[model samples]
Target: MNLLKTSVFNCLFVCSLIFFLFFLLLFPKESFNAALNGLVLWFRMIIPALLPFAIISGIFIRFHIADYFSFLFKPIIGTIFDLSNEGSFCVLAGFLFGYPMGAKIANDLVVDRQLSKNEGEYLFLFCNQASPVFILNCVAINCFKNENLFLPIFIILLSTSITIGIVLRKFFYKSLKWDSKEKVLKSLNDNTSPFEILDSCVMNGVDTILKLGAYIILFSIIVKMVEIILKDFYYLKTLIIGFLEMTNGISYISSLNTSFQIHFLFVLFCVSFGGISCIFQTASMVKNSHFSMIKYLIVKIMTAFISILYGILYLKFIY
Candidate 1:
């Protein structure tokens, strides 16, 4: 396995280097311009989230607040989803934070031997959705320009449906099981210094953010290239463009003179798939930890489908 990883990494490094050189040779003007734009976008969207998130995560984990919250949700989780306390706690955190942060928290708890790896794996599907903060503030209010709280509400509902399907499949249907005999819970020592947690959080955040930025730039170039090649193909371009670039996809769908149902379904898919850019960027960030891209994608696709179903039902009831 180690040998395979090494070989793969070497191949990727070489391929990327070759691509860079070839791009520079063939399209120096575009390459430099694209690189500059990438840097700017990285600074704008990626960098700002790094330090603050790190520090906040550190404080939460270090203070044992996460554990406390986990305990509080234990009963609700057990009753509702038949999940463990740790799982519920991580789910709650994911609801508050977004993407890799949620995944990161679960990863940390697993490493600390607080939850069984299998349970962590199960919770991961539910725990890896857009936070309420992002959906409400960033997407619903800011992006959609509509005050209808239903947007975020439906997003949460759709996310929940996706998580449920993933859990059911992994645990019972798909027969994909996590290692059950890994570890047990830990008593958080009060003496664990605050600085240590802070340092870990900041370092992890920076590393994750930079990794995300690398993927963002790469995927952005791919998106740009694909858009140029298929400039005339409207439907294919719209679909691919939406998948590769999230906000742009939403904008495209919104501009179409289509039915409300189509628009709603597109929005749901954009939120669920989170675009190729989002997936690539997020996968890059959380790759260091025990995150499963396959499982995540499965859950995302399921969520998109469920969101559409819910929208159909909603429209039927309204009409």
Candidate 2:
């Protein structure tokens, strides 16, 4: 399953790449250049947002801040998730801090023999998704101006879906056990100043933002075409566009002059899909880890579907 998903996504990415190149070649010089300009702008937007977070996240991990974060989430994790002490820490820190960070923590746990391989994989499935801060503050508030707190409510529901789905998977497959050997945490010298951490954070965040920005720009061009097509055929654009490029799909949907319910559904779908960009990013991170791209998609898609259903139900009864 994992291999199949990897192959499919890879094919899509390659096709997009080819199409984009063709677009540059076939379009008039001025139009192609304008699209390139847009792509550059998108890169600028995405890189800064992401690069600092990535670096800071790395520094935090290197300094064992993630371990400390794990400690803080212990009570909630212990009581609610019913996880082991160490397992709870990994899960909570991953859930609270950020993406791939949680995965990183889990990977470390697996490497150290603290968490079983199966448990680590399970943690990777659910815990390594978007944090509340990113989804609500970054996407909802910043992107959509949805001060009505729609994003937060949706994220709460989305997280619940992820958790439920993961639990169900665990119930069906059962978890595998491995060695439980403990390893000492790495230490950073005190001479490392706070500025260094800040700098690293900035650099990492920039890197992440730039990558996403480039993707956004490329996707925006494709979306422009889709919009034209939708002018004549306005059904299921969100669904089709999202499967191709997630963030662009979300942005396009958010830009629609639609009703609150439609907007809600669009947001639900966008968030659930996490966009193709997110899947690729996650896949890139786990390339060497024990994580499976296919499994991640299955989990991601299922959770996304559940979130969409929840949103639909909310619209039907509550909204």
Go through the candidates in order and give each one's C-alpha lDDT: 0.64, 0.62
TM-score (all chains, Cα) for each model: 0.77, 0.71
Model 2 lDDT per residue over 1-319, tens place: 9999999999999997897677656654644654676576555544444445566555555555655666777687655555555677666656655554566666656654556666677777777665666666656776578766654455555565556635755584354444445344433565876677567656655655555555556555666556545766554676667666655566667766788677766666666556775666566555445677778788777777777777776667765
Off by over 4 Å in 2: 1-18, 28-45, 84-117, 131-134, 137-145, 165-169, 172-178, 181-214, 221-231, 255-259
Taking the tens digit of each residue's C-alpha lDDT, what string does model 1 give over 1-319? 9999999999999997797667667766666666566778778855775447645655565565666667877786555566555667777766566665666766666666665655666566555666555566545665556658545455556455545745564465443333566454455565656576667777877777777677766765655565556878866777888888775677667666778667767777776667777766656545545667797777767776776676676667753
Q: For candidate 2, what is the lDDT? A: 0.62
